[model samples]
Target chain A: MRIVIIDDSGLRATVLEEGLRDAGYDDIHIVPPRGAFVARLERMAPDVVLMDLGSPSRDTLEEMLMVSRALARPIAMFVDHSDDAMIGAAIDAGVSAYVVDGLRKERVKPVLELAVRRFNAFAKMQTELDEARTALSERKIIDRAKSILMNQRSLSEQDAYALLRSSAMNQGKKIVDVAQALITASDLLGGGL
Target chain B: MSLRIAFLPLTDAAVLAVARERGFAEEEGLSLDLIRSTSWATLRDRLVYGQVHAAQMLAPLAVAVTLGLSQQPAALAAPYKLGVNGNMLVMASDFAAALDPDTGRRLSDPLGTAHDFAAAIGLWRRKPVIGVVHRFSSHSLMLRYWLASAGIDPDRDVVLRVLPPSLTVEAMRAGEIDGFIAGEPWGSAAVEEGLAETVAIGERIWQRGVEKVLAFRTPWLEENPDIVDRLLRALIRSASWCDDPANHDALAQLLSDPRYVDQPADLIARAMSGQIVVRQGEAPIASPDFLLFSREATPFPWRSQALWIYSQFVRWNMVEHGPEALAKAGAVFRPDIFRRALADADVPMPGANMKVEGALGLPLAVGSRKGGLTLGPDRFFDGRVFDPERMEDYLTNFVSPL
Candidate 1:
């Protein structure tokens, strides 16, 4: 797996790099401390990111948050210390693991593994949430279309539902998609249905 | 009570460090875990999210967080102030050359130096980029206030970059920023390394200016009043010890530990003792009262001081002025809590919760819970008085078309 290390301190970065290499991770990249960092990370496209913020300011923390939000890769952050607000922000920004005051060479592999595992678990849960939300919204749209049909055509709810299903099957689209199209047409045509 | 406190590695963190190291907390029946943070934002976050019981936080930052400028609005309370007036503004040697030639005079007279700085800005090669620790930091606000006095627009005339105080020297060395205003040892560190020269000291800008405070989430403070009281009492004793002349050397040594400021003993000593070396090869200048710990009830969390910080937020357009927000900002400084915590102690505190900020021009006797409290000069260099009661009027004095 490609790994990236983000640390402003050269000595700390070197130590982290050596530890990662010792752990048999050959593909490693170090992010430069300055310039367009997110763009650079996107181009590097590492599977895992190990960030060492020796002492981060609010601006640096915000920048790191943006990186975490943009990248889908599992990231582990090492800091001398952290506060609750920053940790909350890091978690919200999708940082998989945040290790504070335990950045020794011997501890690297397990932390990396945990970070990846946690990130994958979180990503899976996020995907499930997105799917559930999509389904719920689709059901809402389908119900709205059914009610519009029932109101305009003087049909029962079951007949309106059947009409939507038939229309979806004939058009080779999901029922929700067909319903959404019908709603859009009704609204665009001044609801003249 | 077992309390885990987060703090940045600066000299001002002495009270917390001493409390943990000197067994002050243990004496108060509390076990203390002091975590050294690198940034104010992280420390603020730590307190807000309940990762730590409390934190050594920037006074303005606490207000800003409550005002919802820095992060999600959290009602943070500062029942005690850790230290006052311990920061400095250091400019690159080349840039410093353009300012007043006489270093001693410039350092002594802030307003004259500010005028000199205004003139120097015109001759500079570029709009000088000055690094400030944080947007909501007292250093940045003071920098703005000092620069504005000479008709220099901080927003337009110069570039203010945000960098951690520890990284300030490297940024200046890399030519990324021309100068930086940060808390002690970092400024002293730059001077020691011959990377920068001290141009402005926070003590001279506004004597006894509020810097760091003991901050906690309001809910946490309210829930653990007994613990908070214990911590404050411990902190009060620690502050007195930290202020003792005999303890300065030991305090400097403690701060130099890798887990703390992690700098040379002498660099930390200079700021701690109020004898700062503005430039390399220069004798240390006596800047007494440079960093106050407990003298004159320095730990007392004055509510008016909080309003003064809010007024700056308004002056800088960081937040829109509203009575509700103003009340919230002022409420962040919990003198009531301080009074409750120190009620039994020998500590003399102001009788009133608020005072006319920047009004004191000399050491004056003030009405106190236990009289005989003499406050040091609390004057703004520009001679502007901030009446907390008349915040709108105070703000109007700084109204411009910015």
Candidate 2:
């Protein structure tokens, strides 16, 4: 019932570990992002390995555990042939698993499902963080564009905002898009805001 | 009208890129969304899980997938071959310097160099670790064949590390592996950066050796014949365009885009044009037929080729040898589907589905159903032929490395 999580991102691995811990699986090990991975995995002798699909070392793991039969016990990729939906969700969530051969599907299914849920949650949080960063950057761009409009046309902030909104509506674009266009044009005209 | 295909970033992905970028896919009323994947395993998962309609897969991998050697057993079908013979075997400069001084001769005579390699392995500081892209890859199988011929047991004499093609050069720089066999322009990139020297070309091991095949889930391909036909048509056009020397520059540029191979255009161009730089600051060697995308039915999925891969699997003990396993492996390459798709096209189609592999010593024009076709010079480096009908007899010739 030992579990090993192989991930380059410490944050994501910690998230998955916390989820697994809450599920009451106490025997858990986390392999660091890089280094002599095969030797470490051999030493750990994990009953099940949960790996990030994006890691390039997955191939190395495959060669050692699957092809070369370097491990004393055979390990097969955890595949629930009956649950295609779950498998698809796991792959989309960027998580993959390998388990010691002959491990029952029932024993591993909940663990895999939990990993998938945690991965999806982590991915959503990452998306939100990226969007928040983008929002901050775009807000700066819009402010710059507004100031350029206010300074060049000798208008107030309210007037510059209304002009940007009107231009966005007429051109069937977002206000941010129009603001970005204005900034680009202003930069081309050698004007600084 | 829309199809998503997953592919690893390599020069052999040129057909897929050309089909999408050159408007061939558009001309056939199809829209192709090419997903650049980081590894072969992920690409297989994407195709198996229905995230992608198809994938640019290693031919042996497609067979292995069907045979249930990797991951969940999915009936993956490869109806079209993306390209052939673009892989290079590169060893670190220090290790290669122990072999032949003439880089061109080293590649030209792989068997001689392989013996030299065996001799040099003892002279090395430690057991040389050779990086292969995947365990179920053609390059790995070829490396096994090339090394075993010199009595250098791949498993005993060397360590085979599996690294993605993109990471090979960096792996070399980090001193993690002594050499690697992978598709270009990763090999070219490594040689260009002066991290490694070319020891062998895949083409020299087996002329017109199978590389990447356009793979799809069997059920999807079976259920949607019309879409498959259209895709094959688009790929055929793209492959012809890719094979033309006149279009090498444009094709190289197209593949150099961030979304594709993402290497320098000049480096990518070498593989396509068959002009390779084996060593840093050395003159390029012209092999002329190094990589083939089309012409001589390079795009055709020959069933014999799949059986050849199966033979390697049995040789290496990767899969249990049995009638059921053999049938499953051979069926991975669908020549029937390929012929059905190209039935009405102006291009020539081979009359038979299988042939004696490595039997074609020189290019010979053969009778075809649609037009004139020539196939050949598909000789093995060891000069052995693989007859699909006599697989047992063919396999008896090899002494198992185990």
Candidate 3:
């Protein structure tokens, strides 16, 4: 039931430590990305060694390859199956995993489960942040689409949203789809579509 | 019509690049599609599995695939030698200058430059670490073969590691590696940047060594024999175009562009022109056959080159035993396929076997070079003489005149 976290991120480690503590895990330990990292890795020998997903310490991880191999410990990490396309993206993104061998597969589930949740949470946060920034641009696209609709049918703002909503209901499409379609068609026509 | 053939974008991959930019592929109803791959393993995987129809591969890589050196119990049957030469050894300047006294003369062997290099490294106070692009590559074997011939222990005396050709210059600059053997742009780039000195051009070691070749999944080549023929014809034309001095500027431009080497064209042209640029501040020496794609270098698919590669396989214990080595080299190197490709385009085929004695020789004064056993150094670590006569014949069987 004991696990140690070895990551370069202090803030991430703090949050993980707090979360695990709240989740009733008493033997959770955290180590930073410097000296004492390997000693802690060896001394703690936790059931799981949870490191930050994309820290810029791959060389450190790579340097550990020989030592890990010499010790006959094969480390594997969670390859993001939920996002298959992300495998290449992750390799590009510097996301990698290393789990020591001899750890039972079933016992490692919790480790991977936590890592996936953390990664998903991080990804979801990124998506939301991107969306927030693009909200203005998306609104302008909708405005462009709306202007075209208004010019074509003399529909007001209220009528336009209503029409779009009704169209979504009929076609089972999202409002973004209708907005995108309208914007694309209008651009192609050299003005309002 | 253009065909999108995937290729690992390296400097020595001249024929494919020339075909695309010089309109040679088009001459044979082929459009060039050169995809960049990070590793030969990925290149082989994609080419073998049909993700990509064909590619410019390590000559031995094709042989390895055909011979099953890589994925044993699963051998690939493919045809064609893609291209040759344009590889060299680049050593840290300090190491290059530190020649061992016994080497007799100042280091001067270009073809087997690494062999003399192994001598220099062996006699060094510390075992010198050598870098090559890949474990299965000829660069690795060449370095090992040269070292073994000089009576040096490849494993004990030197630390060998693979650093991708693209990263070698940077690695040399950062001092992470002592020296490296890699194809064109990487070696040339090192000299241009003053990071490493060119120790030797590959042609001087094994003479007209087989460098790169087109390899495809057996099933793919079988189904598209006409396309293969067309592709080969285009490649040959590109090789011819590359050989012409008039096309030098164009070849340089194609490789220096962001799509290919993405380095300075002049540096790449240094190798492409067969001008041996030593990494040290020495003048560039002319080795006419350095980047040969056409002329006498084109056809013949010299069996000697294939045998040289097999000699290394035996030396390294990569083939611990048996006819697997010969079969492997035979399977991937399809001179027959290359000839078929050339014939369809009406390109005249060269001789079946070539005499490379002119390029084979020894260097004056190995640079701090240690001594190596004269034969297979790894499997026969006790300094036993391997049957070179037998090995040579085994290697020449598949690709020789027949």
Model 3 misses residue B230 by how many Å?
0.7
Error of 2 at B186 (Å): 1.0
Candidate closer to the true structure by TM-score (higher is better), 1 or 3: 1
- Can you tell me which runs of candidate 2 are displaced by over 4 Å? A67-72, A150-153, A185-189, B400-402
Per-model DockQ? 0.18, 0.63, 0.06
Point out the higher-scoring one by DockQ: 1 or 3.
1
Give the interface-residue alpha carbon RMSD of model 2: 1.2
TM-score on 0 to 1 scale for chain A of candidate 1: 0.49
| Off by more than 4 A, model 3 | A1-193, B1-4, B71-74, B100-107, B110-125, B279-282, B297-300, B351-389, B392-402
Q: Whose DockQ is greatest here?
A: 2
Query: Could you give candidate 1's per-residue lDDT for residues B1-402 as a string of tens digits?
Result: 678898888899999989989999999999988887776656765676667888888899899889887755688999999999999999999889988877888888999998889889998998998988888889999999999988889988998877788878888878888999999889988888899999989999999899999999999899998999999999999999999999999999999999999999988998878998888889888999899999999999889999999999998888999999999999999999999999999899788999998888899998887857999999999899999989888888984634
True contacts kept of each: 0.42, 0.67, 0.00
* Tens digit of per-residue lDDT, candidate 2, span B333-381: 9999988888888788998999988988899999898879999699989
Q: Rank the candidates by lDDT, best first.
A: 2, 1, 3
Task: Name the runs in model 1 displaced over 4 angstroms.
Answer: A1-30, A35-58, A61-193, B399-402
Candidate 3 chain A: minimum summed lDDT over ten consecutive residues — where? A56-65
